[model samples]
Target chain A: MSQVANRHDALDVVGAQWQAVSPRLVTLRRLSLSIVLVPAIVVLVIVLAVTQMWWPGLVAAALLVLWLLACVLIGRQVRAIRYARRDDDLVIRKGVLARRLVVIPYGRMQTVDVSVGPLERRFGLASLQFQTASASTNATLPGLVATEAQSVREELVRLGEKRMRRL
Target chain B: MTGLEPSISDEAASPLQWHRVHPATPLVRMWVALVALALFTLREVDELVSGGYREILALAVSWTAWAVLVGVIAAILTGFYISWRCTGYAVDDERIHFKQGVVWRTERTAPLDKIETIDVRRPLAARLIGLSQLRIEVAGGKDSYLELGFLRLADANVLRDELLTVARLHDRRPGAVTTPEAGIAAEHSSIPVEDALYEPSAVAAQHVLTIPNSRLFAAALLSGEFVTSVGVVIGGVIAVVITGSFATLAGVAALLWGFGGGAVKRFTRNFGFVVTKSDQGLRIGRGLFDHTMQSVPTERIHAIEVRQTVLHRLCQWWQIRATIAGYGEEGDETMLVPVATSDEVLNFLAHFGARWTDEQTIALLVQGMAGDRHQAGDAFQAVPQRARLWDPLGWVRQGHWADDDQVWLRHGRLQRAVSVIELAHCQSASVVQGPLDRKRSLASVEFGLVSGPVSKALDHLDESVAVDLAERSVAEDRRFRQAATAVAGKSGQVL
Candidate 1:
């Protein structure tokens, strides 16, 4: 236990083969952020070019810095997401700063949902959500390779049926 | 998992004999609506005579108007009667089949084993008419709630017994033993009524706890809501006096009404609370005007929570609530007892298969109730000092304890609540950390539970402790299940 405490990944499942999300998720994140922020940057540039005001210049610089910060944060967040299907339970770990780990027995799962946003579709990634009887369970494994997500969903559904439990 | 199948069936394999609810079931509820409709019609007819609508009243010496009103009443009553005629239910060996509706007919089938609760509810009106309502709650959702209402009270009681005998919930083999700490309760036949909590009355089942109506009333007075309501009313009155304003008196009247209504509701809901144990499950009887008898199959409770405010604590009173498998949070039935002595609470816990008979376990449970007193040994996995950042006064008070079968979480500074959840009931587990917890290498853990009053979480433990606790829970759950299966194999029963 002390050794586990000393380890950095102590809160995470240690030996189980962990599956990381598609790195393309980071690109997808950047793309979505760009969709929302690039226009503002463009608008700011236009406003600055028309007026050549010093404040707009400062604002543009600030926007650039903010965009750069978002890029780093999104990359870390996407990379942090990991999930593994252990013998008895499915473990999901995510978050860069705070971190979280969830282990749910397949029998407790009521349903599995797979969804893909336009951005995620462009990046060939899908998100899996597992619903259990408990409302507190927040087991959403996002940014999985599309095919892997489908296979995992099927596997989970099969296992869930084999060990189905009432709420 | 074991009881979900129609196994241990005493139910006769008889052909479906469809039965209709009391013909008056529709009228019980719709009568109120019908009265409202009649009153509105009367106002309209009165206006026709008194106001400018006199021309309409003069058409046929008012007989046409009366005839139209009577026709409308007849049409509505016919609609209700038709609906009553259409509604029917049938019980076969495997499931309950209910079909209702006159135009767009709807049918529902609930597997006998999946029935969560079979409760007898007698609304005041139904009681007055010597009728009762049987509500069969299936755990999945409200859409599955089946109500066979306005049955003769005697008929409802017979049906409730018949359904209880057939429902899979009753087949659950007894012990939901949690961990290594609580030994398997060997004797369940009956315990002596030496404890003061039991009313010294001869009863068929083990007379466990019976709380009187006066105690319920006193507990309500000591309740937080009552205190808050009084405070608000007093504050309002003082404001009116200081401002010399008559307008603010309306707010005071509203406050008074709120206080009186709340008190009446508390009395009606919790009157004559009693818990009894039998071979099958625990029987909870409560309520004043609308009597309810809830048959809680002992194995169905996911967790048990005993709570107290400072005032109630001072009076040595505690309120008991349990998370029955599919009970909605707002349902009055979740309450096991409204007011109980600590001894009565312990007596109740023993009924759930915990080893309250053991001195050490009793100590541990009591310690869990009041929270950390810096006790020696493995009494609790106390929160780390770093938790003080989040809750300075309460950091020392919060704790988590597990004895192979159950997990106990106790926390609070002024008002403390301890929740006892058997390991068998935990469906999932989680370890979470906020940014601050991450900085301190600490995490809080929550074991997933069915929706009810039980809030199972232990915050701010060493990351290692949290992870170990959560992971060990899966192993514990599996071990308990395997042990239960082994016992079942020998005994021809499943836990």
Candidate 2:
């Protein structure tokens, strides 16, 4: 019984160190979605105007519902996103429904990339990605402040090279 | 520099010069381009014919047409020649470098010590021309290495042996006296240096495993892929009969035949597969139409997976696969055994340095049908009761065993899978808490090995247990590396 109790508290120590990204990520997410969805909605409205069909209106409304649901889900997902730097490994945890926790060793990191789009730049946000040996180890952290992304990229790259030399 | 330069006395001592591939290399490499050109010309001929004989006669008589045709041929020949001439490769003391392209010059180099595997592949056309392609898989992921093609079979083998020797030599200590003297002596010797470098006879010949043809054929017949393909064809034919779509029968038949033939051919390619143990590495040779020889060092293997599909479980058979870096690109290269009984798989895995101390793991695998031992208390740490919501059926049997050498995770009830990841190969560990798991205060611990799609997870453990295991796995990974380095230091060979 003591063993079981000990097992339950293992993660309590780890929860203290996780750093959350910026809250403005929710706005960036909505803006990126609207860029594509707004145009799509316009096209659907145009189709409805020309054809004057009930089905197209129904389809447009359905899409609006989906977009609203996506906004809510993306907000939750952004809230759940957290990154932590350990002694030897970098950990990223995200997702709400089907959660994923990716831990990549510094020694295994081959490349660290920072990408920012026009919309993200306007929102002062950028994404950082690290490529490891395994193809499935998709180590990505999005919605970080642009300055934070740059510092993280540089730090990870430097740390990766140092660990690699030790190997 | 003059057109006719004088030969120097130290030419042999100088760094290896960049050597160009054979002249025929261009033709072999650009065969796809040539085929496209031929098809385009044929289509042009069809248009010309429809335009009538007069146009054809006019084209024949026209000097411009003749000049255009000559120019096109000349342009193609010049391009091929330039591409071939510009591409050159050199293997020096420390690295292998390849330089290619005319306008956009590109140079690629791979450190000699980073080469993970050397494979000699021969396609049907290359085999017909008595040539082979040498692929050097590097430590990094795809697109990080170089592939040189269309070399004479003998030359490719010699170059492969040289690279292997350099890789082995790079791992030794600087002051090791026997290696440098032996290396120099072996270079000058008339016989191949590889034969003298290591004692091949140290590994007994009887230990090597060879799969016979009959077994391969039976395995193919029992495979789920083969059965489903046949069923699809039959189902299509039945639909055609009921719908009376006789006109579409030929097209459907042709498609099915093509698909079925490719599957069968792939299945039978490894009919006489043989794996032999050598001083440098394990040498694998197989395939009927395109014979291939590949060598991978034992220490490079990342993880091992033993899969038993629903059908395989009924027959008490398992398929063993290894997750080797730079191997998962091709489906067949990573396979250890296509199909084998529990005993055979255990025997084969023993050679690869996996030992199952507890017979309970094996018993659970072989005789899981009885269902009596599913809940038996053993050394394995079973998942908590909260896991019943996630796994439900197999929650009792789902457990993890972390011995000194390997960490094994078993899951699933009907189609069971047991992944044995060597402790040494574990690069990192992670604890994942899903929404459902967080509610129950449980988490899953995942061990990240070298690049491969297959993953191993010990799911639904107590949150504390998961984190503890993750930390322990990292410690074990460090210990394994230290142990390997110590062994390599003592043996004077990079195991």
Candidate 3:
């Protein structure tokens, strides 16, 4: 009974960690989209200016600012999100507008890669990419401290390895 | 199968002896330096020749001498770098470890149980240099669990033998035992070898089958008729002035030579093909001067495809390829035979335990002709319900599903061809609609199979039907995976 209770408690922790970490991935998604958008918007504004269209230039600038503001807001919202790991699964719950809860069982994890990008490095953060057997289905737990990401990756790898052994 | 009794002491002892690999040979450094010097010389040659011709010639000789001196110095530096960076590999009873890299160092360690194959490749140059490249392919990632690129051939062979011995020992261990006869291996290995073995060969053979040399020459000649006509007009004028009219003959010779050169290039580049059995599974090595060796372990193959073209049918040739689990070269798809005869293709597929039916051949023809304008009479002769909305020119056909296979045709004012593809082992499916396709109410459904280099697309179907088919294919893929896993479990080979 104690063992079962301990397992349940561990599972609860895993679930909480997964929930805490997932929404933070939106920061990466927003950053990636913005990287593409900013250059495109700049090019569009330049093109409009070259065409001697003052109205289109102003409209493009305004749109760029709005996009920047939206990006900032999304980044903040991502920082606020978090996830936790349960004994058997990882739980990811987030979203300011549309709430979502995702549970990924430990057995499903094929690989856990910890990566740090330039921006993430500035923030002293790392992202853990959880890849499953299915190519299309994967989850990223972003915006954790580097140490936290390492610990989480190691823990997940351990659990995943154990599950693999059981199979 | 012989079950040789393992000696008790052999199990207890370590199977490997570590010997440090030699540094990268002097020849490698010389080769690099020679290329660099040649480029530098080419850049400076004209400038030197223009000013101080004699002095520059002396400078050029001195430069060669300087390059040799620098090469020697660089070789020593590189030897030290390589020796410091390179490490020996050894496999103990349990695991294998390889430590080597220059600046961004990496030490890979994989359990002996995880090892798939230990391959040693000896290129002509490497053989002459007395070195071999050892690549240890594991069950995981892009990185060779261990790669020693410049090891003495003897050392590499010993290391390969040791790793293989350890892997075999690990496999035979009571808890870790995995044998191909365990049922799951049959299905896992068979599907991919079967699917990929035909399609790529068929696609490749099309180049040879369609447009024979005479036809190509005729086509070229026809296309260049304007130029020839202009030449003839010039020759008519020149004939009146010239003693023997040699100019016209010269012009004809040049054109023939140009056509002959093009034909020779096409033939030579696509020469020499052989698909043979290797110790692991199958080896497909082809090309005239530059040979490519592709090895596909029967188990790692996810899918196989056999494709035939209209031209290939006349020649009775087909192409075979595989969609494998791991990525190769540019990306995932690896061709077993770019081109081969039907019998050779069948022999290759037979190695993987798959056979094609007579009905499948007819099915292929039907699939190819379904949306083609050239085969319109045949298309209308036995029109399946799936072809109801198929526009040979501007008809919008959408939302038709035919069992496991789907056909789509894009018929416009000029364009025509049928895309008939299978969707059983599909991994992802999508329906794409461009502005033109949307205006015509036509869409293309792409099926991503588990094994192969290319996704099969059924184009010019009705939008709704395409979407429905995409959804159904994805669902079917999921179902197949489930069935495969269940089948895998019953077979009891370790996943």
Best by DockQ: 1
User: What fraction of the true interface contacts does model 2 reproduce?
Assistant: 0.36
Interface quality of candidate 2 as DockQ: 0.20
Q: Model 3 chain B — which ten-residue stretch has the worst lDDT?
A: B202-211
Q: Rank the candidates by TM-score, best first.
A: 1, 2, 3
Q: lDDT of each prediction vs. the true structure?
A: 0.75, 0.69, 0.50
Q: For residues B214-328, write the lDDT of model 1, one tens digit per residue.
A: 9888888877668878887888879988998878878877886788678678877989888887654788888888888787877678888888778887887877788876676
Q: TM-scores for all candidates?
A: 0.85, 0.72, 0.48
Ranking by lDDT, best first?
A: 1, 2, 3
- Chain A TM-score per candidate? 0.90, 0.83, 0.64
- For model 3, what is the error of residue B299's alpha carbon versus the real structure, in angstroms, after optimal superposition? 1.8
Q: Fnat of the models, one by one?
A: 0.60, 0.36, 0.00
Model 2 chain B worst lDDT window (10 residues) = B1-10
Name the weakest run of 10 consecutive residues (lDDT summed) in model 1 chain B. Answer: B193-202
All DockQ scores: 0.43, 0.20, 0.05
Better of 2 and 3 by lDDT: 2
